[model samples]
Each structure stands twice: as structure tokens, then as C-alpha cells.
Target: APFRMSFAASAKHVRVLENAGLVRRKVHGRSHVIRLNPAPLAAADKWLRYYERFWRERLDTLEALIRAEDKAATRKRSRK
Candidate 1:
């Protein structure tokens, strides 16, 4: 069939996905149904979220410094 993968290839991919904890499958009469399990993905997301707050605080400090410099430059220009 055109634009369709063979069942063997699809099954291999499904197995790989299952091993990665990204998917689960059930065999039906002639075809298999696949479902995604987000637990692993969620754990990764949570890990990244923990770092996001830390980076945000650092970026906020940088922004404050930039603004302070901008204000100082404006003050100096006014004195010219």
C-alpha cells in the first residue's frame, strides 16, 4: 500500500516507544491500538520547571541592572 508502513515496521516502532515509557499498546483482532502515557513526560517537565524559576530570578536581576544603567545614562545626558 502507498503511504502506509508494514505491520512489522510499525510493531518495531511501537515496541521501542513502549520501552521508552512513552506509549502502550493493545492488540486487537487485526490491528493494534496504541496509547500514550504521559507520566515519564510529566516527570521530565517537572524537572525542567524546577530550573525555570531559578533562571527567572537570575534574569530579573539582570533586567534590574540594565534599567539602572539606562537611568544613569539618561541622567548624564540631561546634565550635558
Candidate 2:
């Protein structure tokens, strides 16, 4: 095998993906062709993007707060 896994292990992984609706397998005689089902992945991508933006906004706010605190500390140091 080009990969580290044996054929049986690879088949098990493919079966899991098929059960999850993440892949479709077509069998022709001795050959099996596996194709990815992109719908689930696309939905996951959309979900992740929303959270990415949410966290980005939250992090930006946190950065602004930290910077304000730092500036206040500097001003206090200058006055002392």
C-alpha cells in the first residue's frame, strides 16, 4: 500500500465515511469508485465561517480593551 494502512483498514474507513454520508461508493465488478459528497462539507464550512466571524469580532473587542488598558497604564506611569 502507498499509505501506511492495510487494505482492510482503508475499507473500514471508507465504510465509515459512507455511513456518515460523506462519500458515495460505486462498485463495478472488482473495481470500486468512491466519490466525496460535498453537501455535508459545505454545510460544515458555512457553520464554521459563522463562528469564525463571531470569534474574530470577539477577539477584536478584546484587543481593543487590552490596548485601552495599556494606554491608561502608560498615562499613569507618565503622571508618576
TM-score of each model, in listed order = 0.65, 0.91
Stretches of candidate 1 exceeding 4 Å from the true structure: 1-16
- The candidate 2 region of ten consecutive residues with least summed lDDT is 1-10
Candidate 2, position 71, lDDT: 99
> Per-residue CA lDDT of candidate 2, range 1-80, in tens?
59999999999999999999999999999999999999999999999999999999999999999999999999999998
Put down candidate 1 lDDT per residue, 1-80, tens digits, no spaces.
76399978977988999999999888899877899999999999999998999899999999999999999999999999
Model 2, runs deviating above 4 Å: none
Q: How many residue pairs clash in each candidate?
A: 0, 0
Instruction: Tell me the deviation in Å of residue 56 in model 2.
Output: 0.6
Question: Per-residue lDDT for 13 in model 1?
Answer: 86
Model 2 backbone overlap count: 0
Say what the RMSD of model 2 is.
1.1
